[model samples]
Target: MESEYKHLQIGVRAAQAPKERRVLHRVWKYKLMYLLLLPACIWVFIFDYLPVYGISVAFMDYNFIKGMSGSEWAGLKYFQALFESDMFLTAFKNTLIINMYKMVSGFACPILLALALNEIRVKWFKKTLQTAVYLPRFVSWVVYGGIITLLLSPETGLINKAIEWFGGHPAYLLAEPGYFRFILVVTDAMKEMGWAAIIYIAAIAGLNPEVYEAAVVDGATRFQRILHVTLPGISGTIVVMFILRVGYIMSAGLDQIINLYNPMVLSVGDILDTYIYRVGIEQFNVSLAAAADAIKGIIGLAMVLITNQVAKRINDSGIF
Candidate 1:
């Protein structure tokens, strides 16, 4: 019994020592880095988190005059109203559908584009393609919206003119429910695909040339070398990006939808953000808007946690 107690005491001390050492070491080694990051950290705190306390408006009969603290507490009335309303349901569905489409197309297209771009041997051509593809990412949605609208207009638009040339009747592609989603997907894909590929391409570049050389020595073809060596090397980036994409499953492209959507196409194109904008800001119902924002925020957080947990279950690389 005395020996057992001694062993237990030693084990307890050993377990506690590492944690104590960790705290001390972090202070000693990473203190400078932490200090360097302090300004950016404070900026995030000021802008991102300081405003979160105002989320209480979601639970209250918010009045602009009363502000957050003075707002009348109405429990779950605002949230209940959101769930019960048909308009909310339609908006929620549209949000999820468009976001899911964005998630899949946005995710897959970039990976494929990155892989294809990585294969090009011509230095100048590859650089030009990369620049051209990624250039749209920097362009504002407002500018791209005008471009898309002008090009897709039913009357005398480039697409309609092409349709006429082919002896097919010109159609308002953006007006039709079926084609609106496709246009959104394609245009969004086009705008962001090159930019998205940047990270993957960077990852692919980091792979050791020796691996490729070894494969070639073993009589491996270029395709086989890429399939086995290049792909596995960059999969961690893929996994990380995929997890992030899943985390934002509730967020469709608001700017794209706002600029592109018309009343005729609202049934298919209207999303939660747009709905919230119309009901909260335009209609001046602050509490209801706050409630909608709260629900989306909670769901998005849940998605990130679930996705991170899944990634950790498969491998150690996860946001958590």
Candidate 2:
């Protein structure tokens, strides 16, 4: 029994020693880094993690006066109501359609833009072009939407004026449901394409020059080198970004859509976030909004997991 106890102690100590060393090494050697990260840690805890408790409001008949603890537990009533509502179903469908459209088109545009920009040999021109394209991204959606409204106006807008000059009829683009989704997708792609391309450009920049030299020696043309070397080099970055994008498949662009859309286009433009805002803030149905939020979170979590698994299977790279 004594010998057995001795052996057990030795094994336990051996297992714990490495863990202790790791903890101590992190504290001792990387204390400055940890200090630098402290503010971000606090901010995340306060803003992100702390608000997670509010998720419980989804299961309760939340009342501002009663507060969280005093609110009556209503179980899944709000969730049931949400799933049964025709308006919510419409919003959910619209959200998925719009998000998928944006995902497919928006995802490809940045990569193409990055490749085109990468081909520019003139440094000053490339920098100027990059700056010019990226400026739109920094513009607030409200301001950009106003600009778009003016540009697409049937009477005084440049587009309609051009159409009239060409003997075509003028059209109110934003007011038409058929044209709204197209406008949303195209405008969003234009706004963010430059900012999105920066990541791919950085990935392309990190590729070794030796690979290009070797390809040149093998008589590869510029396009051939880009297709073979540049793309493959940045495949990992693309995969990672794509996986992250998939995680947000449920979230249609709320800010842009809210600013640009009107009652005429609400049939196609009313998305989950906008619906949540209407129910929660406008109608004062707090529990219903919480339930909608909970559902979105669950779907997003599942998407991330499934997408990561798919990415791992296909390319052996994933966010996980």
TM agreement with the true structure for every prediction: 0.90, 0.93
- As a whole number from 0 to 100, the lDDT of residue 186 in candidate 1 is 91
- lDDT tens per residue, model 1, 1-320: 99999999988986778787868877889889889999999999999999898788888898888787787899999899999999999999988988888888999999889889988999999999989998999999999999999999889699999999999998988889889988998999999999999899999889899988899999998789778988789878888998888877777888999999998899999899999899888999988998999899899999888888888888767865
TM-score (C-alpha, index-matched) for candidate 1: 0.90
lDDT of model 2, residue 320: 78
Tens-digit per-residue lDDT, 1-320, candidate 2:
99999999988886778887868866989999999999999999999899889899999999999999999999999999988999999999999999999998889999999999999999999999999989999999999999999999999999899999999999998999998999999999999999999999999999999999999999999999989999999999999999889888889988899899899999999999999999999999999999999899999989989989998999998987
Where in model 1 is the C-alpha error above 4 Å? 1-32
lDDT of each: 0.89, 0.94
C-alpha lDDT of residue 168 in model 1 = 93
Residue 230's lDDT within candidate 2 is: 94
The residue pairs that clash in candidate 1, if any, are: none
Best by lDDT: 2
After TM-score superposition, the amount by which residue 128's alpha carbon in candidate 1 deviates from its true location, in angstroms, is 1.1
